[model samples]
Target: MRIPFALAALTLLLGACTVSTGAEPEPTQVAGAVCDVPDDLRPARPYRIPQDEVAADVAVAFNMLAVSWSPQACRSGKDYPDARYQCAANQFGLTLHGLWPNGADNKHPRYCAAPGPAIAVETVRRHFCMIPSPSLQQHEWAAHGTCGWDSPEAYFAQAAKMWDGLNKPDLEAIPTQRLTAGAIRDAFVAANPGFPRDGVFIATTDGWFREARLCYSRDYRPMRCPRGLGAPDRERLKLAPKGVQQDAQRGVQTTG
Candidate 1:
């Protein structure tokens, strides 16, 4: 007999529900579900998805495709089968405004209601956190396309971990002063040795630093970067409060 599709889907959602396993943090607990995940969003389990691979998820479960711009506001792609989207749809290609997507000129009658946009927001949010297109389609499609987890708890836990990992990297309190790019990189590789070699991490770093430069007019990427990836770029590597790189580099060794 075929296993129920829901059971199969559930299997995909869980890391190893059937296997004998040690108790672990729920996705909500580990991911910081409560604050980051809205009430209407799904909760996540403390699943260990890779960092670089998290952002590309389409998160269309909000059924945004079910809604489109006015016919005039949309354009066809160069060819068929790839499909067309709203004139403002950033998915078509590199957009002038980046992914700061423009609003659709119209909304579907079904989605004009409150839950509609909420769902859409949730769908889009997954893309922000690195939920790539395929994973979103496979795991999030039937769930109404929200970019969040199964429960608020899971969402919050995941959020918490992400926030801590990104926003504050003392390298397990090893102190940032003595942390050279090489040392920090070593520490980072030690902690996450299994991470795949991919450009997404670089992309995410670029995104983070770009945002930092835009927001603070200063290099704030290290504040949120993991130690390994935190090695300062030659041009902007200095994390010194006094804007003195060599001095700060020396201080780390003195303290440690």
Candidate 2:
């Protein structure tokens, strides 16, 4: 989910059977399998960030967590159906963007060290989508992953822990209408107690939901989002109709 801009926008679904009870229903499966696929490296309990000596910003994000995904990926036409970048948006509603390190500032440290073996493509697909592409994966490792752990597996394993903790929102729960950024944040707050209103950051291109970020303290606890980070809480946003995000550029309106 790391990008070059102030914040990067990153790009979900469900089980063996598919279901959509509303106009903007979220997916519950992926590739005809249960969306909640398990990974081999998942820890028996939540991985806690160590309270050892570290920089102040790194310490600030110890225990916090957030969820992010691209509604664009679910829409068709933007990416070829068979392209390596295509997403199973219709199957597993919201794709898992990477679990990132939250910082007190807009920018954070990256490429802290040399990366180890590249995470196998198969391993990545087992848990989430592949829109980052292989090259982006390497970049994410150097920029964000390396700041925390040594190997790609260890960094991603910890990321998996954060991804598993949050509950995906039911986009269908909202009426088929434009939503304010504040409204979207409220929905997440309703589902996730202890996740502060300020902790949730919405990244969008105009109105489309690009990524939903959450800030945390070094101990893995939720904290308020940094000032001037994320989309405005009151900004009105739109949900691209299914398969239409390919041409959604015209509709994109915000910097995020």
Candidate 3:
């Protein structure tokens, strides 16, 4: 299903938005020097999946660019209205869904051990408007973050860098009239020079566009989507109305 950042100090450190519909996502704002990605970090490389494996094996994902539902949609009048998630959704639009790590086969590693929480609740408060929630932060770290980094701080710092580097399309500008998924994917390809056309995937419910995903290689470079992700480019697609309320558990799956 749908899935799942930062460090503070030797003794203490860890913390972390909100998502708005039809609005541009806010830039991540993190305080302290630790928030930056290390200059020496090595990037993951990409390779084409073998044809034989493509059919029998599960889709492989190195990293992904995902958008999440607004806090009001996820928490408003719900059994558990997470104040932190709501706070974040209110401040940001299309917040990061997750950065997942997967293999070519069915095996996917998740919820790995972490030395401690990725970010403290207070640190989470500092970037509440931009980050999704504390639970998401921890889940992402324990599941996907551990595969890419040794500590939550390093993983979060890199995530910030990835978000910063993305040349995402403007979802706010999606045309309301009849459109094809190809047109939607093209919008993204136009914005991101190196991004592959087949790499963009869509997720929706009853013709309402819920989220768009962008796949990346291990080294953080764009690559062709293996299969079974978004709609075919030529297929007709629909976008949800502006400010559309999403299901409470939006982004429950972590894969790209």
Candidate 4:
């Protein structure tokens, strides 16, 4: 028997609306990364316990891969002693900020153990390309690393693995007028085919793009980001352009 005309139309509409459930995108190496680390690079300062910081060994609900836009960090002149190294030649872009284990409702675990020994100077030098700051690397190990991994080496290895896996977009290519939080997220998803759109979060300061936080499950698969994490989609974003120095005295914004 022939199907009813209305039913046939409905079936066609449903077929057209069906969503594809394809395999997830494989992670690729980031392009245009400029490490250019110096041979003599050393920790700007010795590691010390973060004053007024306390340990919160709460249950980890998920993981976040925080990546920084190096130009923005350098332009702000905030990371100070760390800036001496990271901003020296300004060759970094989309550097690994840290891999943090976040708990539910923002009660993330940190500084899980007392300061043992400073991370070996050689170890700090090895990962300088990825982190750029020796003191920050040591701090990350003592604070976030202690809560998850047993040794600094293991923690950094895991972080490096994840950092190398991401296919980061080249921010300098995008026109400044079209650069927005949503545009950055779109670029990320486009670069990583099976990556979820909501998995990327943008962090900004004074309307400048600072960081991109990618949400991940315990197994390290990309997942939807929690609400209220970073800047909204429509917010206009500015980039501090690699090699172009910002006039902090005048608070002028520069584009690549």
Best by TM-score: 4
Once model 3 is optimally superposed onto the true structure by TM-score, how far is the C-alpha of residue 113 displaced, in angstroms? 2.1
lDDT of 2 by residue, 113-161 (tens): 5555656655444434322223334445545676777776776667666
lDDT of 4 by residue, 183-210 (tens): 8988888878888889998888899998
TM-score of each: 0.23, 0.63, 0.62, 0.78
* lDDT winner between candidates 3 and 4: 4
Per-candidate count of clashing residue pairs (backbone under 3 Å):
41, 35, 31, 0
For candidate 2, the TM-score is 0.63
Candidate structures ordered by lDDT, highest first: 4, 3, 2, 1
- Candidate 3 global lDDT: 0.51
For model 1, how does the per-residue alpha-carbon lDDT over 1-256 read when each residue is reduced to its tens digit?
Answer: 8999999856544421011123531222111111122222232222223333333334221111110111111131111111111121212111111111112222211111112212243433342222212222222322321243444234334432333333212332344545344433433335444422210111112211111110100121222222132224322222212111111111111000
- Alpha carbon deviation, residue 157, candidate 1 (Å): 18
Question: Where does candidate 4 stray beyond 4 Å?
Answer: 1-33, 44-46, 50-52, 79-81, 244-256
Model 1 lowest lDDT segment of ten:
247-256
Q: Once model 3 is optimally superposed onto the true structure by TM-score, how far is the C-alpha of residue 231 displaced, in angstroms?
A: 1.5
Candidate 3 residues 1-256, lDDT tens each?
A: 3222123232132222222233444333332111222212121111222233222223445666664433333433221223333442333345565676666555654544443533554434433443445555655665566666787667776777676565546555766564667777787789778788777777654554555677788787887756556676667765533233434453242322
